[model samples]
Target: MLPEEGVNAVRVVVGMLVRGEYEELETLTEARRLTAAEIAAAVRRHGRDLISPPDEAFRELGGVAVPREQADERAFHVDFPLWTAQDGLSDLTLGLTVAEVMDGVWTVELDGVHAP
Candidate 1:
């Protein structure tokens, strides 16, 4: 099993599958003041799982993903296989941060998906 923090973070991403479908959180928030490019680079460096193939990442959980979009600078799409047992593979958009792209610090929030 993953550590408590990892499970919590993943849960947040899974929860996003509910209703907000088009809103993506900005990697650069006014408070943090980091640029998108910087954030992306940071994420790329530290959060390989953030950009890794969905199936590859999900394999740790005994599941697989049907990728609709290859991970890119902004977002990626995967039918998450284990989010809901009844739903099976549910379509989910993994929102990208500039840090995730450029390789930034590995935080659960920074490495997580937002609404997309």
Candidate 2:
């Protein structure tokens, strides 16, 4: 099972992914402010299952390392499989700040990419 925090993080990630608003850094940053508890509650309210444990649901979700110019911060990169989306690849790349992963949200810019 995914930790509550991880579950929460995935919730916002999935929501943004579904909305197609995840391509902008500013939008993602705003979405990242949502709390894990908030995400969990939203998931329950929305009746959606977006993430599972590392060995389970997320096994297909690939993770990559993100390097930050600042020495005090560490970032992570993630890519959701093509199956996660209704159409097209909703691959996601996330950058987390010092704030707990459950609380912080980072944004990426998707330029010149059009959704079908």
Q: Count the backbone clashes (under 3 Å) in each candidate.
A: 19, 1
Tens-digit lDDT track of model 2 for 84-113: 223233332232332233234433322221
lDDT of 1 at 59: 41
Identify the candidate with maximal lDDT.
Answer: 2
Model 1 per-residue lDDT at 64: 25
Model 1 ranges off by over 4 Å = 21-24, 27-116
Error of 2 at 2 (Å): 11
Query: Candidate 1, residues 52-111: lDDT per residue as tens digits?
Result: 224444444321222323263222223333232333333333432221232332232233
For candidate 1, the TM-score is 0.28
Cα-based TM-score, every candidate = 0.28, 0.37
Report lDDT (CA) for all predictions.
0.33, 0.38
Model 2, which residues run further than 4 Å from truth?
1-7, 20-26, 29-56, 59-62, 82-116
Q: What is the lDDT of residue 2 in candidate 2?
A: 29
Question: What is the lDDT for 70 in model 2?
Answer: 59
